[model samples]
Every structure is written in structure tokens, then in C-alpha cells.
Target: MNPTHDWSTTPVTTNLVRGAADLEQTPHGVLPHRLPAWARAQNTDGQLAMVESQPSGVRLAFRTGATTVELDVLPTKRDYVGAPPRPDGVYELLVDGRPARRATATGGNTLTIDMLAGTAETTPGPADTLRFEGLPDRVKDIEIWLPHNETTELGALRTDAPVEPVPGPGRKVWLHHGSSISHGSDAAGPTTTWPALAASRGGVDLVNLGLGGSALLDPFTARTMRDTPADLISVKLGINIVNSDLMRLRAFTPAVHGFLDTIREGHPTAPLLVVSSILCPIHEDTPGPCAPDFSEVSSGRILFRAMGDPAERAAGKLTLNVIREELARIVIQRAARDPHLFYLDGRELYGEADFAKLPLPDQLHPDAAAHHRIGERFAELAFGPGGPLAP
Candidate 1:
């Protein structure tokens, strides 16, 4: 036993005291400690919104029941129309790894906790935190069906002693921003978000501001980024801008500059990475609204100004290819003065090679496996030692 370590069974408000205390926490307790699953634009201001759980892997609050355990779930924010066919309410439940009573919730503004003496029913209006009272205390792990995202702290229950903090190196926030890909699109669980997976793999905390369908280099977004706290940061840009078809080369260049300038305002010296868009065959040089064609499964093409179509081929619109080229140039230009700045093509995370093999089930969002692959690659590339994660 190392002397510096606290090996005592006695009470300590701080972390455990063990020998040779060279290690504080293992990389287990990744940061952005709590997870905030979704953000929504109610009217204009994007506010944090919560929703019902998915069909599986819900992050739930657990307590021992004499014969049953209680469960609580939060809904997804910005529940887009493209979401999986699962209903927007509680549909099922399980206890002590055994099937229990099931229930459902009617559509309402608020979601909540419920009581299931023996059966689980999906009713409505219990709102935030399910208390599973009167269950046999033999249940060890309680699992629920939901996409558990946006958690900060995890606490232990039914004990006199305080719940120990999850072990990990102290919080090292990984600030990331991107499109639907980053928003856990079609991903299995909350922890499957690329940012979340990478954070866990790299042993860092995370601050994920990945918005679905909202990465269009908007002035407001840049301003929001500028104001946010980012110790280690990366921005995945381009695809959305291309698909949005909102600007021309004249405006695009200035827009990119403005966005970077804004982010720099807050994190002047942090390790900042600028990413170009990933390969989307249709959207590479094509422009967008990238809407659903509803005509064909593979009709996910970029919408752009066309010679024949009065809407397209307008001013100086640049495609993802154009942006990727310019982003390199911009980094090359500004990074001369800002040595900390770096660039990574989005394809580095998910390139044409991967795309060909794992075409997205939806034209926009990658499937579960793709999300994990991207996360693993990111963890290795950005957070690995001597990598971009180094302070």
C-alpha cells in the first residue's frame, strides 16, 4: 500500500485515501460531468429541452424495492419528425433483469415518475424522477428502456455513507460542436454520442453542443460558442452550410472568419480544431435544405442554386468541397499567428471509404456502428497523448 494513498475505511468527504496516491481517478468519470441530452429552439432562443426515453438503454435513477424497483426517464429534446417510430411516451419496463408490469403515457407537455406496485403502466403526468417503492431489496442493477443522455452527477442510494464520486482524472472538458452526426443521430444509447464515447475512451469530461440540423454557421451560433466555456475545443463545420444554401463565396468566407473570430474571443489560447464536412456524395459540391425526398431511399442529395432552377447557382455559393479547401486555407492563414489552431477533414473521422461501406440508413444520420467508429477514431486522434487534447 502506498503511504500517500488513503486506504482507510473511515469517512472522508473527499475521494478515498489510498497508498502511493499518484492516481486521483482513473479515466472512468469522463467530463462535462453531467449530460444535457438535447437543446431546442422553442421560438428563437435555443433552450434545453427534455423528453421520454428511447426503446432501450435509459439512464435511470435506481433504488431497492422490497419486491419492485422504480424507474424515471426524460424525453428527447427537439423530437424531430425523422426520429425512430417509437412513440413519445413510456411504453415498457423491466425490473431486476426480469420482465415486470408495463404501462404507457398519453401525449402531454410534461413527463414524470410513476408507481408500479407489481405492474408497469405507461400513464402520463408523473413528471421527472420515478420512485420504485416497495421492491424486494435483492435487485442489484435496474435497467430501463430509454436513451439516457444529459447527466452531470451520479449518486448511490440506500447507504448511510455518502455516494462516492465516480473515479477519473479531474474534469477535463472536451468542447465539441457539429451537425446531426454529433447529435447522436440514430445512435443506440446516450453514451453512444460520438462526443460522449470519445470522452469516455479518452478519459476526459465533455461539453457537447452538437445541434441537429443547425450547424449552418449562423451568427447567433458563433456568438453562443464565443460565450461558452471551452478548455479543449473542436468545431465540425461545412456540410450544413452547404446544404443550407444560405450564402455565397463572398458571404461564406466572411462568415467562416466571423465564426472563428467569435469562438476565439472566449478560448483565445485553447487547442482549437477546425473540421471540414464529411463526404456526402450528393452534398459534396451540391448545396441544400437537404430535405427528405420521400421519393427514394437514396435520394438524400444536396440542394443548390442551379442554372435552370432560378433558386440555384446564385451569387457565389460554395459547396462542401469549396469550404473544405478554404478551411485549409483559412487555418493556414490565421494559424500562422495562432499556432494552437489546427485543421482536420471531417472524413478523417468519417470519410468516403467508410461512407461507401456504411451508407447512412437516413441520408443525413449515420447508424449506430458508424457513430461508435467515429467516436473511437476521435478518441485516438484528438484526445490521445501528444495529440490535440494536450494542454
Candidate 2:
């Protein structure tokens, strides 16, 4: 918008994107996807499609000497049908790998989701520009982390100076998959997501496939992870499975095996860590087809409750506790043949004491503070000197 500075338009290309699995060429610009086209095409679930396109750990990385940078983006923000208006998605600018400034775009599309009705509607709107100014006028590696939860369509990237794609950091590439909590949930910003934070502390590049309500051990997802190149891989299981009541214990055990087997096909020597869900009291022991507590709707706060009967575990219904036990057993059984495979109890990241201190705001997802806690814990447990992912 400043006429004094000569602005140069740069194309948003895959080389400039750090964390997305695919780049979708849209009319406006390139849209980053956490899942590749082939994998995305295999699933018809609206939630999966929407979340994979949210770009939780995705960022635009380039080297530039510009004091001012502007990006045009059309962000699709989510709106619960009856709850309070969700906050606008945040775009964080990082200079030389450190947080510099943050801004939020206005007047983009809105996706209204009615969980009760199991329906969603999108209302189109106009694109908005995010401008970052007053940077140090020397060449530096710059990264603009996209909103972790919003589905964003990127447009022209303008800078006062010419920009070129930055090379990778020469660190290990960590590919991770999980539920919405891993997808970012209520994290403060894109880079602050637990996985992102862990990757940062772990000194690794991240490819986050944390689909909201969609980490259902789908074969396509397994194949995606199998084919993607990564030095370290982790999958956080249980929460989404229990909440959706997608499968019983009988189905889940084999599904976990098949999923890991598929990944092993491509990454036989990569360090693979299987993580269970963090402590969620509601579904800790109770089997779920979790339902929203409409009683709190009038109070402008939405909470969830497990609806499945506790007695149903005897009938092979899956619960978080059951899933954790099964995952531990499976890892032990498989570790005999696969020495690189490891199991991490999700509770190690956020367990009973931590829950008492920093509880899950939604009874399912960790809040921003909890995200930081989980990230720090993960970095220590998995990336520490003697840890499983240590070099």
C-alpha cells in the first residue's frame, strides 16, 4: 500500500513452502495442503478435507532484505452455528527463525458449522492483505507462518525487495499426524502449535498432518505418511477415534498395525513413535460417541461429553485407556522386529497432575498454555539426548 517503496510481486511456489505436503494452484494463488492431492481425493469427509487444507504447520520461507512485506490471503474462518464468533486466524511473521510480529486479516470467507445437525455452510467473502513493516534492512531468512486452523487461499506476495526461496535448515524432517489437538486446536498461533513448538525445540523441519476429527487410521493417510520422506515420524492416536466412536477395539488393533505397516514399507529405518492421547477425563474410561453439551450453549461456551456406555467396553468399544494399553502392547510386540519403532504414552506429555494445573478448555482439546506445556514435554521426552528421536 505504500507508494514510496517499490513493491515486487513474488509467486507463491512449493519451493517457498516449508511444511505443506502439497500446493494447490487456485485462481487467487497457491493454497497449501497438509495432505497431498492423491490422499485428499480418497476421502469425502468434509471435516477431513477442511482440516487438511488448514495448514497447521505450514509456512512461506524465503530470504529477503525487504523492510515491508505484504501478503494477500482469503482466509476461511470457522463459525460454530450457535456458539460465540470464533476469532480471526493469525498470521505470524518470523525473522531469522524467531517470532517477529503477528497480524490478522479481515473480511474473508466464513464456514458455519452446525455440529448438532452435522452440517456446514460456506459463505464467500473478499480477500484481505496482511502487511508487515519496519524490518531490519538486511538480508535475512523470513518465514510467514499461516494460520493453523483457518483454510487460507494465498494470493500475491509483495515485498520491497526481491525474494528467493530459502533452503532447508539441514535438520531432521519430522512428519506427525494426530487429532485436532495436534492440528493446533486453541494454540496461540501457527508456529506455537504443540507439534510446531516441539519441532522448533527439537531442531527439525515439520510436516504436520494433524487433521481435526479425521485421524481415523485411514489407509490413504497411512500411504501418505509411507510415501512422504521423513527422518522421524509420530502418530498420536485415541482421542478422535473415541470421540467419533469410529471403531471398536477389535477393529482398532489391526488398523493400528496396518497403518504402521504401511509407513514401514517406505520408512523401514526411520524412528517411528506411536503416541496415545493426552488425558481427557470424559473419555478416559468411558467409550464415546461424544456429544456437545448443549446446556452450556446459552452461556456461549461449548463442551463435550462422552455418550457411550461404560459397560460397552466389554462389547469391544474403544476408550482412551484401552487404546493406550493396546498401543503400548503393539509397540512392544513390533519392536522385536523393528528396533526403530517406539511407543510414547500421551499422558507423558499431559497427564493427571498437568491436567489439574492446566486443564483442557474444551474437555477434549488442550488450550494455548497446555499446548506450550505439551510441546516442551515432547521436546524433552522425544528429542532429549537419550530420547528415542535423538541423533
Candidate 3:
């Protein structure tokens, strides 16, 4: 598919993932828009089926002259009825910021860009993993873009470093969990997710558990994070839960404790950071997706695009402020005993001032530039020298 050439001049290195990288953005049961714009975009309606699974894209070009690079571009978010109905064309395989080749995305979320020596379209067998056979030494970095789906969770990094004891119990694995914002929504590509970008800068490894709508104090998810191996851990909570109105105040507090408790089981002494939701005026106080008449709608529907009025929140809903205050209270109580425990407000990463400078498109997710800003803050606060994530 030929991508729509929008030479309107954009940033060269955009944050592929919106806020965090550990978060996985799965379409799940969302409707696929065969709606017109779907034609111009790649994976306009694609999803990764399993939890914490690896999805691969095409490699654009490969060279061995002290460098080898591979990447494929796809669109993570799409609008059909409102925006133009043109499908996002095809995925463009780029090498060092240049369009080197093109990839036809198939299987909804599968597109391969191969540039090993000569050119070949390496396709996934769908039965096994999508592998990039041979990579040259000094590959420096791997960058990805999107015309297809951009919600990518890297399963493994096939390196020649041989499993030789990964050095000092590994580079202090940083485990993070959050919403789709953390799941690389509306970002550029996989490796460029905020978590991945921040990790690269901090020089650490990451295990992300960012689920779209499921981060709302789900025991199963917390169990998954608890069971997963890690050296350090963090949870960016509140936004999705409040927006979705998953649980009540009484339920949320214990759930938060339970979630942290579960994680502590595995990473007993690891540096654990608890992050509250960022600026979201709409559901910052509202507890749920309800009706205009102040009662629960029989329909289990959510107006993600709707702005939660002050009245709505006053009616007894969960807001970011409410969650953050509670989270702070929890962290203070926990930190008194657990020295490794820490709390960082998400807004400290992106606050009201930043909002004025760079407004969010839909008042929820920040754009690529904002992702970079947020990542920088996270890196400085959480992973910089003398920071909590440092060795």
C-alpha cells in the first residue's frame, strides 16, 4: 500500500508511543473501520490477540558497514466517520529517516520490512514468531514508524550477546503499568514509545504491562505484574479507571493496596514508584460513564470523547484529583515502612503548564512532541543519576 505522502514537514524522530511503552494497545472488541480512511492507513483496525505478546513489522533496509537498521511504519489510531475515509495506504519501511521501501501489512497487525544484504519481503508464518533472521554488528538502534498499527510490545531482542549472565542481575528491569497512553497510542512506532525512549536514555530494560481499559485495579493484571520478573517496578494509575468508572472509592483503595501487595510478592525490595493520572479535566472527578440524567445507563456504553462536566463529577464520580489525592495518601502510608516505595504524580511529568504549551488533541492523549517531553521528565525523575531507578 502506498502511504499518503504528507511532506508537510514533521518531526524526524517522533515518539511512536504516546506516554509509556509497557502498555499494550489492543483493539480487542473494537469495530474495524472499513470506513474509507482505512484505505490510506495500515492496520487501521488491527490488534495483538494475546496479553504481553510480541507483534513484528517489516524491515526497511539492512547494511553491515558498521551499521544495520530496520523499521516499519503504521498508524495506531484512526477516525472514519469524521476524518477522511481514505485508508492509511501501506506501511513505509524507513532507514535512517529515509523511505527505503514499502510493506503490505497483512493479518491486521503483521507487516515485515526486510533489508538483509539484498531485498526480500520476509513474511511471518503466523504459527511461530516474526523473526528478522540476520542483523549486522553495530546496529546502533532500531527505529519504527506507522501507517499500520503502532501498538507494539517487543517480546524479545534477538542479540548476539549470548545469555551470558546478563551482568549484575540485568540492567535493573523497570516494570511499568498504565493505560493506552502508556500503550503507545497515536505515536509513531514501536521502539519510539515513551517507555522505550525513556529506557534508552536511562540505560535500563523494561517490562511494560500497559493495558488499554484493563488497568482499573484488576487483580488478574496485578497478578500478572507480580508474577513477571523485574528489578524495579512502577504503576501509573487512575485515568483509565476513572474514565471507565471501573470501581468505586471504597473499592479503589483496597484494590490499589492489593495491586501493590501482589507486585511486592515478586519484587520484594525493588524500587517501586506509584504514579497518579495526568491532567484529564473530563473524568478528573467523575466516577463513571453515566447518563445525562444523573443515573446509570442500562447500556454499558462509554463516551470516551465526552467531557465530564463539573456537575457530573460532583455527582460522585472518580476524578484524577480524587485518585491522585488518594494515591498520595496511600504512598505516604506505605513509604513510611517500605523504603523502596515512592510516589510520583503523573502530572509532574505533564502538568497544566505543559498543557497550555501543547494541548492534547482530544483532551486525553498528548501528541508526539508531548510524549518526548513526558519521557524526558520520567527519565530525569525516575532514572537519572541519583534517581530511584539508578544502579
Candidate 4:
């Protein structure tokens, strides 16, 4: 928008992207995908489709001397039917690996999702530009972390000076998969997601596969992990399986084994960590099939509650406690043959004490502060000098 500045346009290509498995070219621009196309094609679940494209850990990395940078994006924002309109997703700019500035695109597409009716509708809109000015005039490593919760299509990227792709930092790559919490639910920004924060503290690169509501022990997801190259791997399981009531304990153990089996095929020697769900009081002892507590919908707030009876655990129904026990047992058994495999009680990351102080605001996902706590704990437990993932 400033005629005085000499702007140069740069194509948004794969070399400039990090933390995404694929870049899809769209009529408007390129869309980042957490899951590759083949894996996405294997499932048609609308929730999976939506979250995988949210770009939780995805970012555009480059080096430039530009004092001004601008990006055009067509962001598809999600709106719940009766709940309040979600705030605009944020774009965070980092200079030399530090938080620098933030911006948000206005007037883009909207995807209205009716949770009660189990339907979603998309409304098209024009692209919006996000501009950041007054950056340091000297050349620096710049990273534009995409919104963690919005489906964004990249358009033109403009800078006052020429830009080139930045090389990877050559840090250990940590590949992680889990549920909505891991997908950055309720986290303030992409770079602040627990995984991202942990990676930063641990001095590692991150490839986060945290699909909201879709971290069921799916074979395709396991296969995707098996094929991807990583120096470290982790799978956080249980919350989504229990909340969706997708399976009973009779099937969960074997599914988990098979999932690990697949991942070991490719990353046989990587430090593999199997983590159970963090403590959710509602599901800690009770079986789920969690349902939204719509009683407060009139106030534009929604909470979730477990729908299954406590007595049903007798029938091998799964709960957070039960899953934790199983995961620990499985990891111990597997560790005998695979010393690189390890298990972390998710509670170690976010447990009862932490919950007492910073409760999950929605009774499901951690807030930004809790995310910071969890990330710090994870870095200490998993990446510290004596930790399993220690280099």
C-alpha cells in the first residue's frame, strides 16, 4: 500500500514452509496440510478434514532485509451455529526466533459448523492482506507462523526487499500426534502451542500432527507417521477415543500396538514416547462419550461433560485412568525389546495440581497459560539432559 517502498513479490512454495506435510495449490493460493494428500483421501470425516488444514505448527520461513512485509491470505474461519463468533485468527511474525509482531486478516471466508446438527457450511469471501512494517532494516531470519485454528490459503507475499527461503536449523525433528489439545485448542497462537513451545525449549524442530477430535488410533495416521522421517516420535492417545466413544478397551490396546508397529517400521530407532491423556476430571474416572454442556449456550459459552456411566468401566469401557494404565503397561512391555521406546504419564505434563491452578476453561482444552505450563514440563521431562529424548 505504500508507493514509496519498492516491493518484490515472492511465490509461496514448499521450501518456504515448515511443519506441514503438504502444500496444496488452490485457485486463490496454496493451502498447508498437516496430513499428506493420500492420507487425507483415505478418510472423509469432516472434522479431520477441517483440523488438518488448520496449520497449527506451519509457518513460512525466509531471510530478508525488508523493513516491511505483507501477505495476502484467504482464511476460512470457523463459526459454531449458536455460539459466539470466533475471534479472527492471528498471524504471528518472528524475527531471529523471537516473537516480534502480530496481525490478523479481516474479511475472509467463513465456515459455519453446527455441532448439534453435525453439519458444516462454507461461505466464500475475498482475501485480506496482513502487513507488518518497521522491521529491522538488517537481514534476519523471519518466520510468519500461520494461525493454529484457521484454514488459511496463502496468496501473494510481498516484501520491501528481496527474500529467500531459510534453511532448516538442523535441529532434531520431533514428530508428534494427538487430539485437539495437541492441535492447539484454545492456545493463544501457533508458536505458543504446547508442542511448539516444548520444541523451542528443547532446541528441536516440530512436526505436529495434532488433529482436533481426530486422534483416534487410525491406521492411516499411523502409516503416515511410519513414512515420515523424524529423529523423535510421540503419540498422545486416549482423550479423543474416549470422548468420541469410538472404541472400547477391548480394541484400544491392539490398535495402539499396531499403530506403534507401523511407526517402528520407519523410525525403528527413534526415541518413541507414548503418552496418555492429561487429567480431565470429567473423564478421569468416568467413561466417555463426552457431550457438550449446552446449558450455558445462552451465555455464548460451551462446556463438555462425559456422557457414559461410571459403572460401565466394569464392562471394559475406557476412561482416562484406564487408558493411562494400559499405555504404561504397553510401553513397558515394548521397551523390553525396544529400549528407545518410552512412556510418559500425560499427567506429568498437566496434572491435578496444575489443573487446580489453571483449569481447562472449556472443561476440555487447556488455555494459553496451561499450554505454557505443559510445554515447560514436557521439555524438562522429555528433552532434558537425563530425559529419554535427550540427544
Candidate 5:
């Protein structure tokens, strides 16, 4: 706290939060989660719990006359055993719908992860400060978007002037779910994820459920989306399942059906888009359980390779191609009865043409530029005029 400053502290509350579906009160502060308590209760996986709590699309919005604002947050940062150091999460500020400034908070808990061993350890630490100064001296709507990949416990908000929750802009909410790529993997920052970008370009509120390594068409996730209020919905499927070798083609179709079934229970009339997997050349025809190719780790490079035998495709093992075909077929069949349902070939967002120009740097997730490209394309295809999700 600055001795020269007089600030009013606001308690972290749901009324000030945008883009998150739920908030959990913690000992130090309130932690936002993309999934609600009931949905979280259904899944006991530590990974799922961690990713959902990362607050991928969450932000704080308020109106204030203060020229200076500060936020105190305890961030749970991740560390990898053999990989390069992960970049610090970015906190972006928007004033009156335009980017104002960005800041990064240091001094928080650390979670060390060993990818090969599938182990993790956490060390607690103290909260850090994020301060923004010298804003225009006028009442204005301001938003602070939290880091999409880091789990943050918001401690307090302080502004030199009194602040109040910004009234909802009344934009249609778009709830989305997918794998890491959709979860902002390799994207520049929290607000730069493809979904975030698409939401911005489309002028829609977002509830991103792009759980990294956890988007396996889980029924519980579907139920979460079903219960959340949204005018539009999309579910990107395939990569995680294929890479994990979690199921064969025989099980994939039924799982997709069941996932959609759960969502339709609550949102039968909402426009639901079923999207396939983006192009990953390594997994195009080859099957997966993708494994890390850490041979270049010494050079500060991390890559992945499909470990599943391609020959297993004959045994009904799933691949990107197989999943795409199955998804298209399923959507067509279901659309006959459910006219609100639509199918989007994931390749339409990132396909052969995209790879020729901007490739997936790690044989998997897109780089930051690719994230922008995908976000632009999605906005055009899904939210553009005459598109399936268009108003």
C-alpha cells in the first residue's frame, strides 16, 4: 500500500466478474472457475479441477473515475521438468472497450509438473500486486482480463475513486468447450486465445471451457454447459481423445451423442455447433497416444510425436481424419431431427491451406499468430452473416 495514496478496496464478488460461470471463495480471496460447483463435484480428476480453475475467459469489469487501479492476486504458476520455462500469465486492461495496458504479477505459488512421470507438486507463496496508473481522469468502464492459463485467486481491488460493477453490456453469451488449443495453448495471453479473440470480434460474451488435455466429450462437462446460460454454444472435439488413445471409433460416436444429449436437455433450442479437430499433420492419418519428443529439450525445444501404431487404425483406433468423418456424419444425421444443431469441420478453421503458410510449431498447438488467424476465421464462419450461429 502506498502511503501517499488513498484507496477504496472492493471485495471480490460475482457482480464484478464477467466471462466466468462460477466463483469459489478461498481463504485468501475469491477464485473464479469456468465450471460451477455442481459440475466440479462430478469430476474428481485433479487435472480437470486445476484447468477449470485457471479462469481462461474470466475478467473483472467495473466503472470508476480513478486514474489508478491495483489488483492483488495469488497466482498458481506452472513449471515443467524438462521443457522451457513457461511465460508468465498476462493481465490485460481495457478502458471503454479498448486495450489500455498489460501487466504481469509475480510472487505466487508454484506448481512443478513432470510430464513424463505425470506428477505434480505445489509450493505456496504470497500474493503479488498488479498496478495500472495514469488512466484518463473520467468515469469509464474498465475491464481486467485474468491470465487464461494460470489459476488466480483474486485478493482485492483498489481504486483511488469509488468503483461500481459495470452493468452488463447485454451481449449474447457464447459458451465454448475444447482441448488445449481452445484453452489458449501457445496463444499470446489470456485475452488472446482464439475463443477470446472470436468473442471480441463477434461482440459476444464468452464462457470458455477449453480444458487442456481434458476435453474428452465428458458428459459432466456437457451438463455444465447445459446448465450455464448461453445464447450460443460450440464443442470442439477429437485431439485430446486421439492423443490419449482414450477410446476407439466404436466408443467415440456414442460418447459424442451422449455429450450432446446432456446439453440438449437444457438448451434444446440454442444454436449448438459441433466442431471437429484442427489439422495436426502428425495425427492426420496416424493414431495417437502422442508422446513428447524431448530429444530437442537440450536445445530448449519441446516437440510431440504420435506413439500409437498407425496399423491400429485397422483395429478401429481413432485418428483426426476418422473423428472428423464420424463427426460430420453424426451431425448430419442428428440435424434432421434437431434443426438448431450444426456441424463445423474443424479444418475449416485450420486446415491444409493453413499449415502451408502458418504451421503448428510443436506438432500440436498453434502459435500466437495462428491463434489470431483461427479466431478471425471462426468469427467469420460461425458468427458472420448467414452463419449457423448468427443472430
Candidate 6:
């Protein structure tokens, strides 16, 4: 605490959080989760656990007259073995739907992960404080969107003025799940992620489960969606599966069915849009287990290449093309029985033509501009009138 500063301390409660489907109170503090405790317990995979707790779409929304606000957070920052040190996760502050400030929290614990070696080490550090000042000092809606990639434990919140939770606009909640592309990888900022942008344009609240490197058709993830409250839901499948080479078509088809079955258990009638993978030229027609191309790493670049044999497609090895075809078939078959179910070809969002204009820098994840394009396209296709998620 700064003795020179004067502000009233207010404990941030779950009531102030929006976009997180679940919250767990830990000894350190309250941790918001896109996945519930039960779902988290089901998977021992450290990768899935890390990303699910990153608060991808979580934000604190409230109305305040305060000119100054500070939030204390204990962040779990990640470091890779050979890659450049990642920037401290970004916190975006919006005042009355306009970007007011952007900040990064320092002094947090670091987790070193060696993906190739399959190892991780955690080192304890101090909590970081994010401060926002120079507001208009008038009652207005303020939203502080959390970092999309850091696992944050919420701590004390301080404001010079009293705070109240912002009332919802009574819009439907849109729950979405996908791979790193959907997780805002290489995107400009947290709230500017494609899903967040789409949610904003659609006038709906978003709960994003875009787990980077871990969207492996996990049953627990489907069950999490099954339990979460959502008026509209979408699952973006295929890319992660292809990259990991997790399963072939024989297994992939049933996995998709089982995942949808689990979700339908809770949201049978909700507009469940099944979205296929967007174009990744490296794996569009080629099969993968995608491999890191470290040749550019020394030059401060991170790139990926498909490692699987293209000829293996005949053996039913999964590729983006195969998965797209399978997903469309499944959705078409299911739609015959489930009227609310719909299918969206991800290519429609980011396809051959768009790629020509805005290429994926990493040959996998889209850059910030591509995210904007995808978000805008998705908003029109899925959230526009007469669209699957249309009100």
C-alpha cells in the first residue's frame, strides 16, 4: 500500500465478474475459470489446466464515479524453453465502450515450460498491481478485461469512488470453444480477440474457452459447456486435432458425436453452431502433427510446419480438409433431427481469398488484423439477422 495514495478498498466479488462460466475460491484468492472445477479435475493434462484457468473472456464490469482504480492480481506467467520471452499479459480498460487504457502487470510468478522436453517448473514471485487513473470522475460504465493468456488470482480492488456492478443489457450469452486461433494468439489485445470482437458486435456476453494447444476434443470440455448457462453456443473444432494428430477419422467422428451429445444433455435446444476449422495452408490439404520450425527462432521468429505425410490421408489420418468434410456431414445429419443445430464452414470466416490479403504470419495463428476480419465475418454470419445466433 502506498501511504501517499488515498483510496477506499473494496473486495471484488463474483458479482462483478462477467464472461467467466465458473469461479473457484482458492487460499490465495478467487480464480475465475472458463471451465468448472469438476471439469478441471477430469483432465490431468497440464496444458489444458493452464489455459482453462487463464480467464480468456473474463472481465470486471461496473459503474463508478472514481477517477482512479487499482486491481491487485497474482499472475502465473509462462516462459517457453527456446522462444522469446512473452510480454507481460495485457489488461484493457474500457470506459463507456471506448478504450481508455492498456496496462501490463509486473512482479508475478513465472512458470517455465519446455514443450519438447515435456517439463514445467514454477517459481514463486510477488503479486503485481495494475493501476488506472485519470478518469472523468463521472458515473459511467467501466470494464476491465483480464489478460487472456495469464492465470490470474484476483486480489484487492481499490477505487476512489463507490462501485456497483453494471446491470446487464439483457442480451443472450454466447459460449464458444476453439483452438489457439480462437484463444487470441498473436491478436492485438485481450478484448480484441476475434470472439470478443464478435461478441461486442453481436451485443451478447461472451464466455470463451479457446484453449491454446489443448482443444483436443476433451470430454471434460464438452461437459463444461453442457453445464454452463448459455443462450447460444459454438464449438470450433479440427485445427488442434490435426496439429496434435490426436485421432484419425474413425475416432474423430465418434469424438465429435460424443462431444455434441454431452453438450446437448444440457443445451439441446440452444443454437449450437458447429464451426469447422479455418484455412491453415500448411494443414489444409496436408496432414499434421504440426512441428515447430525453429530455424527462424534464432532470428526471433516462431513458425510451424505440418509433419505428417500427405499420402496418409488415404489411411484416414485427419487433416483440416477431412475434418471440415466430416463436421459438415455430422451437422447435416444431426440437423435433420435437431432443428436448432447448425453448421458454419470456418472458411467462410477466413478462407482462401482473405488469406491472400491477410496471411497468417506463423502459418497457423492469425495476426491481429486477421482476427478483426474473422470477428467481423463471424458477427455477420452467425450473429446477424436470420443467422444461427440471431435473436
Cα TM-score of candidate 5: 0.97
Give per-candidate clash totals. 50, 0, 42, 0, 0, 0
Query: 281 in model 4: Cα distance from truth in Å?
Result: 0.6
Residue-by-residue lDDT tens digits, candidate 5, 155-239 = 9898888889888757898999999999999899888899999999999988899999899888879888888888999999999
Better of 2 and 5 by TM-score: 2
Clashing pairs for predicted structure model 2, backbone only:
none
* Model 4 TM-score relative to the real fold: 0.97
Looking at model 4, the pairs that clash are none
Candidate achieving higher lDDT, 3 or 6: 6
lDDT of the structure predicted as candidate 6: 0.89
Pitting candidate 2 against candidate 6, the one with the higher lDDT is 2
How do the residues 1-391 of candidate 1 rate in per-residue lDDT, one tens digit apiece? 2223233222222232110101112122211211122212322422222211111122332322234333233333222232223334332334543435443333323222121121222323223443434333452433333333322111112221112432432467667777767766667655666776887788765655565556667665566566655678888988767666667778878888898898899889989988787777666656664554433423443222311222354555666777898899999999999988999888888888899898866566687899898989888888887777754
What is the total number of backbone clashes in candidate 6? 0
Q: What's the C-alpha lDDT at position 152 in model 3?
A: 33
Candidate 1 local lDDT, residue 80: 27
Listing every candidate in turn, what is its Cα RMSD in Å to the true structure after a full C-alpha superposition?
Answer: 11.3, 1.4, 12.8, 1.4, 1.8, 2.2
lDDT of 4 by residue, 284-379 (tens): 988889988888989888999999999999999999999999999999999999999999999999999999999988899999999999999999
Please give the range of 10 consecutive residues that has the lowest summed lDDT in model 2.
Answer: 1-10
- Model 3 regions lying over 4 Å from their true place: 1-170, 290-316
Tens-digit per-residue lDDT, 1-391, candidate 6 = 3333456877778789987867788666688988777877788888888888898889998888888999999999999889999888899999998899999988888999987888999999898788998987688999999999898998988988888888874689999999988888878789999999999999998989899988888998888889988999999999999999998999999999999999999998999999998889999988989988778888777799999999999999999999999999999999999999999999999999999999988899999999999999999999999999986
- lDDT agreement with native, every candidate: 0.54, 0.92, 0.53, 0.92, 0.91, 0.89
Which run of 10 residues does model 6 get worst, by summed lDDT?
1-10
lDDT score for residue 56 of model 1: 19
3 or 4, greater by lDDT: 4
